[model samples]
Target: MSSEIAKYVSECFIKPKYEVQEAKQPYYLAPMDLGMLFAHYIQQGLLFAKPSNLGDEQFSIHKLLQSLKDSLSLTLVHFYPLAGQLTSLMDEAGQKCLVYVDCNKGPGARFIHATLDMTISDILLPTDVPEVVQSFFDHEGAVNYDGHYMSLLTIKVTELLDGVFIGCSMNHALGDGTSYWHFWNVWSEIHRAKAGESVPVSRMPIHNRWFPDGYGPAIYLPLIQPDDFISLQEKPDQLRVRIFHFSSDSIAKLKAKANEEHNHNNTSSEISSFQALSALYWRSIIRALNLAHDQVTNCRLTTNNRHRLNPPLPQEYFGNCIGALKTTTTVGELLEHNLGWAASLLHQSVTNYGDKVVRDFIHRWLHSPAVFKLDVLTDCYSVMMGSSPRFDMYGNEFGLGKAVAVRRGYANKFVGKVTSYPGVEGGGSVDLEICLPPHSMEALESDEDFMNVVSLPLKG
Candidate 1:
């Protein structure tokens, strides 16, 4: 190890607080597997052009590893109790929190070994330029966290591509997607500050104390068993993401038709757009599932748990504030009934999950030990839908023209998926992503009526 790297290690890892305890579940429960969760961290993730004047200025991987050991020393001081059995939620601690993977030798292959107390610095960010910064942020690691809290993977300058993705793999149970994003953003700010950058204020996240009660105008949900996790591994094939563009006019007409039948005067609402398209494609999926005669198949909608809380959870509060609502019907009913009826059902399901239901669900969830089974429910899952019109797919200014393709790689096998709403031009239209199995998708794609309904323009 280089002397500089060694010194960094000594300062970061050799002298920090530490904690060790048998992993256990806390009150905030989501569907989860009771096992150790894992994630990855990468050090020196970007490759940069060497300085022309300096013949061979390079970093030592061995010494970098030493620095990694030192940086991990900080985790001990910040450890917190694991909540909801989410391995991702465990506060940073020294015990079983870090590992090392040497992938320098080859691809489709790598070797891993545990480090005593791997500090965050052990995974160094490139000092060369912002280009390396973006690369390191983009494509450096993969899901390898299993049976451990965290692991660190270090690549030398020789191993990095023009861009690399480097981040931790955390159990969703530990935190929601919002929390995860917050964690990364904070980590970056802290690292930058340590490097003498003037980082501003850091915000502490609001800890979750609210609960979700499952009680409602009781709908039929197949009780899930403990073995459901094993069954989940064998999902159906229709889980891949497919992108489709709909003209503004088409969506508008669809919303008009939906509002007219459902008596919703406001045709230009996020809820309306989502409901219109979801109903159209869901009807198509029913056809594909060969359930044209059965009437119990349903579509699941994704609900943000933010406003469902008592007094409404703060938007800035980081954690999973998302839940799913199931809208059930048979192919016979959908084909037999008009789209308005379907839309009404969709509307009612969402409306029902308002503040009252949300607060109750959270409260009951806190006291209930009856594990909610996700397996039995997957057989007839809801079509998940949400909107993200402002996701900056092009904001990643890594010097290359903005990302030409921003794809969500989710093999949703046996799961229903929907996209965040991509609002219409002038923020008028609503665009969404739909992911379903091939056969179901083919049915939806071929439905002339469904297309006509969804294609109506914003003003139509």
Candidate 2:
């Protein structure tokens, strides 16, 4: 909250608009194995853009709002579940349980209209994530599946001096990042299509929860108990959110170095750009913290199982198809090992995620209730990384130009979370949005190894 940002907060208004639900029948989405794990969380992001290149002839506040509202309705035809809400209901056995989404009671997604007295450049051009940028999002409280069922998605349209900002808030229990982006892409396509232009055949989403043969429906009935869920509210502390850019060339160099070091031990497996970058960050953070030699450290990499499933899910499969692959080592081992060693650890974890492994995970969840009580933040020395460099973040164009910058609205809340996105400048560059405590972030800023490859564009 800086004085500069406060100046632009003079005028703002929120108008809620609801669309008509297109789906007729009541759709009961029992939490899929993956969905149940994230039943209490939400995913949010903001897409910033300058005014549409079409000028006033095609792009105006009124036109933009109408297009968004209409296209969202059309998009709901394919993503109907998003227009619904999550609820806790009693099963035939009289057992209370939570459903991922209840489409029977539908009010559609929330469409908000807002105006800001600022320009897009004032936000996007900054190297760091600007606090004021968050104002564009709908500040609705956290989702409560046990209580009142609210909209699964909300979109906020903010008019800036030179552009418009589209902010999206989605319930994680309904879907994952892939589903979120899929809905956005389809909505954008429908918005850009001309009156006579036929809407492209959208890849229909698959909702059936996958299970191995012989598993009874009761196994997935209630994946979480009332005492197992944790509040989505963030811990109270000051965290520094910084965006670090790594160019294609830098990533390539890091990959080459990792491969060279790994080959020295005669291992045929090579590290990917993602593994290399992640390893680098892990090492940098450990060095910055200067932890004790015996301190245990771990990395939790979010792995998508859509393709890794036994038969592979449909390309259009929605909902949570994600799992975490974790690797652990003592602080001393990490500090003593070369970059390749750390990268190989990550590479091996990903390579080990085969069909059987995923199935085993489901079986464990079915039998074990303690898994639901596991706290992600219980381990202080762990870092959780998510998102992918391959996500088409810049491809979202709603009859306007491509987004100049893409950012997550809630990433700053997780203390040791790191999310990666394709750089706004395009090419093979990567931008990592990292959230860390003030001391850890300050240490990272001064870490020579990290500074060598990361470009801190905002720092003087």
Candidate 3:
């Protein structure tokens, strides 16, 4: 182990404190859920500044771990699917294969306690993300296919000198970013509940997984074993990660500028803050790469399917409900036009993903089940967005202190991949964590058109 990640002690499984009522139901993996079978576990962290009242016993490392474990046990009673392991079985034909969570005799969540020599600034202030931040998470190189025997969810609490990081590795096959944060929010609420309270989780997860009416509930695949279908995503040594923060002011200006032209020229749907920001990023990154203007590129905009389905799944739907709504355009067209032109493409794509479009996607996928691979997602000319700026990042407080920053672990990352988070300042602000090659990173830092709105030299 490196000096930065010093101690690894106390490893155990945290099962539910009481038997769950819904445990009897067969947990289904829908087509959308299984589409991510090859992706890495979603690894992310919440960094908390040490409380001023450090002398109190409640602030001790032992106290924090005990509380986290206890509340997590309570949380798992309701979110028990997370405590299960992925299992594969042959079809009736004995030719095809399928995978589902084994909740009956499953092992619970894996929890690890560790210490680090670094401080909070070691992560947040760096222009280039430090290598040590990768160690804070579990299942560093593990993909979702490994969940067959591996724990579906792993939480590691790394205590630092002046801060602490709670990192979680969640099987991507089980949930999307929405479900991941939903679990985090519930766990935090339980941890923060009063001593005499019953379970305080306000947003209870609904464990009934969904699929198009006639199609799924259990989607079959072409492989016999996960190994046959899985392709490991190797870390790209050329890519460097950088975080660019945009204040609420900058976001509003971008939105106004994009919407101004849209409102002037056309009477379609208005450009959203997210669409406007995505346009800026897509254009800037494409410009930095200096790709041939005529070259074709794409922006894969991550959309939550919960609200887009015909009947619409409730927010509490407890499994994967996400799809990448893609927009393709030639580099020449994207750069030739103004911001409004690019923003409109994104706006149309987002607003156009209603019932018919969503169902068409589902129907098409049912006919051919291929998990998302790394090729189209990592091209230097292409850009993909993950995580949402609307996620309640700072609202979860686990009785210690409010989270100051949200950071991600080293998994499923490649050049041109970006993750967005609600900026700490709130009020429509956003932080974009962009990973690019060293040359592109340097070019982006100096690109005046884009840099003008970005908050430079991110403070820890």
Candidate 4:
């Protein structure tokens, strides 16, 4: 590990307090069609809470770990699939393919107790992505479950000088961002509630996988061969990740500019804040990279299909219900057009995903022979944006207090990929976590148009 990472993980060990398995029966899970595509990737996030709110009397490392372990066991009773492992099986046709979660696996999610010698400020105030924050998660190599199908979740609780960091690593195949947060929220609720106090039914998870009437497990079987694991394209050796904060005012300015241009062109379409900012980031990144004018660049935006589906899936549905909305155009067209033009294209792409379109997408996936592939940035010019600012990142309060700030793990390292989170300061601000080549990032930092909308880093 790098020295920067070593500084945060001063000491770490698995807590043996709640190591026993709690599930009584094996709950087999053949994930939704969309879930099968995400089986290989892991999604992680770090929640940091300041020490002031959780002093020794109210919260100590020992008490926190015990609470987490105990609450996790109860949480898993409801979310039993999490305590299981993802395994591959042969289908009825004797085809060597089918990835499903076997809930019979022993033991539970890995819970680790760690100590960090630094304060929360030292970790989040850094201009660049902090290695310390990344160290909170288990390395990909540590848990090889795709083949053997081991644990689906891992929790690391690290004690800091001025706060506590709760790190979670969840198998993306079992759930998407919605499912991930739903589990955390329930765990928090259970942890904070008094003993014997019932957790609200609304906070519980719904795990029934939904599909078309005739479609069944066979349609969701794994298509990629054992040796054909999907991996991201090669990124620059010297890539950098940084968080750019866009306050409500800045976002408003961007929206106004985009709408003004749309009206000037006599177009009936109006752009949303998400589209405007996404357009701004798309244009800014391409300009910073200085790609060829004729380069065929693409902007891929992830849209949640829960509401778009006909007879929409339950809000608590616990798997991937996401679709990608892509806009393809030459770098010349992107650069030559005003912000409104790009925003219009994005808005149209998102709006086009009605009930019929979503159903058609599901139909196409069910019929395709090839495994579904997550669209990663394949080159310097291709961009993919994910995560929404609407997610309640700061609302998780696990008895200690609400998280002061939240940071995603190293999963966002793919070149040209960006993830957005609700700003720690709240008030309708958005934090854009961007990854790009080092040189491109330097240019983006200096770009007048990009810098104008991004808030300056806060000073103590």
Q: Which candidate is the best by lDDT?
A: 3
Best by TM-score: 3
Give stretches of model 2 more than 4 Å off.
2-42, 52-58, 92-95, 98-100, 125-127, 139-141, 144-148, 196-198, 216-231, 234-236, 369-374, 456-460
Stretches of candidate 3 above 4 Å error? 1-3, 54-58, 194-200, 229-231, 264-268, 376-378, 456-460
Candidate 3 structure lDDT: 0.83
TM-score of 1: 0.56
lDDT of each: 0.41, 0.68, 0.83, 0.71
Query: Which whole-number lDDT from 0 to 100 does residue 67 have in model 3?
Result: 87
Assess the local accuracy of residue 60 in candidate 2 as a C-alpha lDDT between 0 and 100. 73
**What is the TM-score (0 to 1) of candidate 4?**
0.89
Worst 10-residue lDDT window, candidate 1: 4-13
Which stretch of 10 consecutive residues in model 4 shows the poorest summed lDDT? 11-20
Q: How many backbone clashes does candidate 3 have?
A: 0
Q: How would you encode candidate 3's per-residue C-alpha lDDT over 166-192 as one tens digit per residue?
A: 999999988998999999989888888
Instruction: Point out the higher-scoring one by TM-score: 1 or 4.
Output: 4
In terms of TM-score, how similar is model 2 to the real structure?
0.87
Summarize candidate 1's per-residue lDDT along 1-460 as a digit string, tens digits: 1112111111111222233232122333232211111212212111122122323544443443333333223321121222111122222452221111111111211112122122222223221112222222211333223212222212121212132122233344344444544443443334334433223435555544333345321111123232434443343553434445466667677777777776654444343766776777676556655653754677776566666666787754644566667787777887677776788778778777777776565555534423334454456434555434433222222212222222232222234556643433334445455666656666666777765555432321
